[model samples]
Target: MKKRLLSRLLLTSLSPFLFINTASAAEQAMIVFDASGSMWARVDGREKIVVAKDALKQVVRQWNPETQLGLMAYGHRR
Candidate 1:
């Protein structure tokens, strides 16, 4: 019981410091999509590009908008 109490006290004291370091940090990510001709090819009667777009949309829906995100697509032109 005594050890548990001390552990809890230590955690309580340190929690503020742990959180302070995170407040100024913004998470960032980059998503690269291939728009190549192959992506336009069909699989199971569904174009690969269509599948990729749907998957990306679903992911963005669940993601926190506060996170910095960048997107790039390749192979749109010759």
Candidate 2:
């Protein structure tokens, strides 16, 4: 039973990244993105931050403007 529980926990933990292609169906959904130094790195031809914000904005734009949306960024402090 313990082994099964452990496997389930691992599956749940990895499921988020594993199903990145699936869009959320919730009427309201909030996404938390880490905006630490790593996001400043290069991605494709632009910085990761630029890419992330653009991607987020693209998604947010697709949803209803009145739809509940929230964003929080964390950590770049000394």
Cα lDDT tens digits, model 1, 5-53, are: 4435444543343222234478666667678999888765667677667
Instruction: State the lDDT of candidate 2 residue by residue for 1-78, as single tens digits.
Output: 643444354445433532233255644445666589987876445676666665556555666764566665676574
- 16: Cα error in model 1, Å: 31
Q: At residue 35, what lDDT does model 1 achieve? A: 88
Question: For each candidate, how many residue pairs have backbone atoms clashing (under 3 Å)?
Answer: 0, 0
Weakest ten-residue segment in model 2 by summed lDDT: 13-22
**TM-score per candidate, chains pooled:** 0.65, 0.55
lDDT value, candidate 1, whole model:
0.62
Which candidate has the top score in TM-score?
A: 1
